[model samples]
Target: MKNMNQLITIAFFVLSTNFFAQDKQDQQNEIVAVWITADETKIEIYKEGNVYLGNPINSKGERNTKIEVLNLEYTNGKWVGKIYSKKRGKLLDVECLVEGDNLLLEVTTRFISTELEWNRAKS
Candidate 1:
C-alpha cells in the first residue's frame, strides 16, 4: 500500500507539471485579434508561414486605407517587424508588444525612433 501511494504521488506531480507548462506556453502563444492605431486606422494581423501580415480595415465609418503591414516576427518576448510607407517608399523597422489592452509599437529609422500605442480592437 505504501508503494502504491508513492507511485500515485509521482504520477500526480508529473501530470501537474505538464499542465502548468502547457498553460504557460498557451499564454505566450496568444495572438491579438485586431489592433487600432491612434490615427483610427484599424488593422487585422495574422501569422502566415513564419511571419505576420496586417491588413487595413474601415474604422468609425472612415474609408479603409490600402496600406499593409508586413514581415513581423516574434521572439524572446519582442516582436520585430517592418512597416512600409508608401509616401516615403521605404521600409521602417517596427517593434511591438501586447501590453494589457494596448499594443505598444516602436518604429525605428536611421535617424529617429518613434513609439506609438494601438488600442486592442478585439478580445
Candidate 2:
C-alpha cells in the first residue's frame, strides 16, 4: 500500500508539471501569427531562434523590402524588445502583450510613450 501510494503521487506530480509547461508554451505561442495594424498594415511575427521578429507584408502578401520592424523576446510574463520607428528613424523600447485576439504593443522613449493595438489576421 505504501509503495502504490508513492507511485501515484509521483505520477500526479509529473502530470501536473507537464500541464503547466504546456500552458506556458501556449501563452508564448499566442503572439506568433500575422497581425493587422491600426493603419491596415500587416505584420507577420515569427520565431527566429529564441527571439521573435516581425516584418511588414505588402498588399500581395509578400514581405516588404524594409528592415524588420520588431524584435522581441518573452521574459518574465511579458514580451520585451525594440520596435523600429520609420518616422523617428530609430529603434525604440517596446513591451508587448497578447490579449484574446489582439496584440498590444507599448512603445516608450525618454519622454514619451504610446500604445498600439494589432488584431490577429484571419486565416
Please give the RMSD to the true structure for each candidate, in Å: 3.9, 1.5
TM-score of each: 0.70, 0.92
Evaluated with TM-score, which candidate comes out highest? 2
Clashes of each: 0, 0
Model 2 spans > 4 angstroms off: 64-66
Cα lDDT of candidate 2 equals 0.92
Please provide, for model 1 over 6-101, each residue's C-alpha lDDT reduced to its tens digit, 9 standing for 90 to 100.
Answer: 999999999999999898655444544577878787777777676677777764644244666645877777678898765578989988877788
lDDT of 2 by residue, 1-123 (tens): 999999999999999999999999888878999999998989999888889999999879987747799999999888999999988999999999999889999999987999999999999
Q: How many residue-pair clashes does candidate 1 contain?
A: 0
Model 1: pairs clashing at backbone N, Cα or C within 3 Å: none
lDDT of candidate 1 at residue 32, scale 0 to 100: 43
lDDT of 1: 0.74
Task: Evaluate model 1: give its TM-score.
Answer: 0.70
**Superposition TM-score, candidate 2 onto the true structure:** 0.92
Off by over 4 Å in 1: 1-21, 58-67
Q: Candidate 2: how many backbone clashes? A: 0
